[model samples]
Target: MSDMYKAPQAELTNGEEHGDFGSVEKGIAGDYSFSISETVSEGWRLSKGKKRTVWLGILLYVIALIAITVVAGFITGVFTAEGDASFTQELIYNLITTIIGFPLAAGMTMIGIKIARGEDTSGTEVLAYFDKIVPLVIVNFLMAIFIFIGLLLLVLPGIYLMVAYLFAIPLVVDQNLGPWQALEASRKAVTKRWFSFLGFLILLLLIGLAGFLAVLIGMIWALPLLFIAIGVAYRKVFGSPHRA
Candidate 1:
């Protein structure tokens, strides 16, 4: 990693950068304050001078995405290639893919956390979360089920939960929390700043769209920015991990 990507070891001593959340602000949901602008700005600070490293991370991510898509497509092709596949078959295929794809999702989060922490990241880091596979898969599965149920009730609640639990994966991988614990922690951390999180998400989405529009190659770079931004938000919300 270049100096741009290297965070000084001294800064790592402070486990929680946001300080005690409840001490800062209170909300109807609970206490905990977050600044969407500050979080995004911190993300930019982490990413600003690290263009080369960020692009490398993105390239690895894109390659991984392509690989996963190809494998999923191949599996689907096997069952549906016969042309007699039914809705049930497709549903089963989707579930299978979701289960198998959990590791990649976790890997992506791990990469994001690493980048945010200024740790060295390489293509191999994409699969670093595989060792903690069970909890990662369980956490993701539970989050999806709850979010879907919430969506069934109303659009707003579902969207709320989506942002509420956005940090579950990072919590799981970074904090070593259980599935339920991670989900609940993520919910609590984001509860006070849900709207801000929404706005942040929208900003990232627009950035991603811009990447797509830029000759389709810009996503290779934009993807890292998105991940780093998320990392920044995660840090701002939950604070950094305790480094011994």
Candidate 2:
């Protein structure tokens, strides 16, 4: 495995440099302005020749999700006599899926990062972040709780947070931050241009909707485009791993 794929041995300090990649702290504090057109175009450019690998990764990810749901449903079914799981059982099922899902989600983010950085991917990159599974799960769990609470209080805070923590998983995978650290870092960095990020997400959602309308097979293309775009955004927010 390359250094890019490996987790950092030491916790990143504020403004600490990561070799030729530059300081993430600097990137965070620097200009948050980025053109969605350029970002999406760059993503499309990087994704051009890697369609097969990207599609395969998405397919595998979907399969894994279905498998997890099926297994969870089976286990929860054993405890239910009415053919419907109780609230507790449903919650348990969701918890099981969420715990198992985050690492895979991180892997997907890593795959995006890899594409953004022009690194090679084997499609099996979807399975690669199990090493960081603990932090991934914890960060996601905390994010879910916070977002839920925010939603209960007022709708806007939850919406704000939904956009604010976009880079949390990437932070964990790329910068090797702990759970809380990753969440905070993502929130703070994205807070600078929260509306812009929201616009970016809206644009991505539009793209996804367009893809879904195209018989869903277009998602193989759209999903990769979205991830690569997100990867581009991640690199834009943090610093790029490669030297310019």
Candidate 3:
């Protein structure tokens, strides 16, 4: 089995080698940190020569998304007579998609982590996290509610939570932590360097935007690069488990 599939034994500390690729260097104040440039550069490097696999995985995910949307729409349509859906129908549709999307998103994160660990992947691994659907769904739902409430209070709090909780799902999946525990762990870890993490997210957003503007084909590369970069950041902050 690939090291990616094996359960990690313990969290890696500063200066530990992630795999055969490289080691996580120590940052200021003895806290874990990652360079935005280095992280993205590593993402680009790993993404290189793996376009087909990455694209295939994206295609599968997109198809699954479309399938769910169609199914949900069809189900919603059964309740409405007009072409437009009722508010309740729309709510139902969103609920369905959101519930299903959590695990899929986690799967993508898993694939990114796998790639960051220098393992080969087929992209189809996006379907692998359904086994942990309950916590995955709960954590995401709670995250959305908190972010929504924070945004309602003021834009800054919402944005803060947005960047802070970025690793909640990954922690849940990788460390097998419960929903609230994952949220707290992610929030606390990210709070240490919240601004830096926000900047990293902004840079990634820019990269994703650039890909979208490049005639859309760039997404094939851009999407994988984004996820891989995120995975790299995740490893930097929390460290990886020991591979079997």
lDDT of 1 by residue, 34-112 (tens): 6767766666666665556655555666777667666765677644467776776677667766665677676776666
Clash count list over all predictions:
0, 0, 1
Where in model 1 is the C-alpha error above 4 Å?
Answer: 1-33, 49-58, 61-81, 85-93, 217-221
Superposed model 3: Cα runs more than 4 Å off: 1-30, 76-87
Where's the lowest-lDDT run of ten residues in candidate 3? Answer: 20-29
lDDT, candidate 3, at 135: 97
Best by TM-score: 3
lDDT of each: 0.68, 0.75, 0.75
Candidate 3 on 1-244: residue-level lDDT in tens? 2334432333222124443222112211226656788889878876665556566667778898988888987887733546667778888888888788888888888788766665546678878888999999899889999999999996889999999899889888887889998888888777878888898999999989999999998887898899888877876776555532
Please list all clashing residue pairs in model 2, or write none if there are none. none
Weakest ten-residue segment in model 1 by summed lDDT: 20-29
Backbone clashes in candidate 3 total 1
Better of 1 and 3 by TM-score: 3
> Residue 240 error for model 1, in Å?
3.6
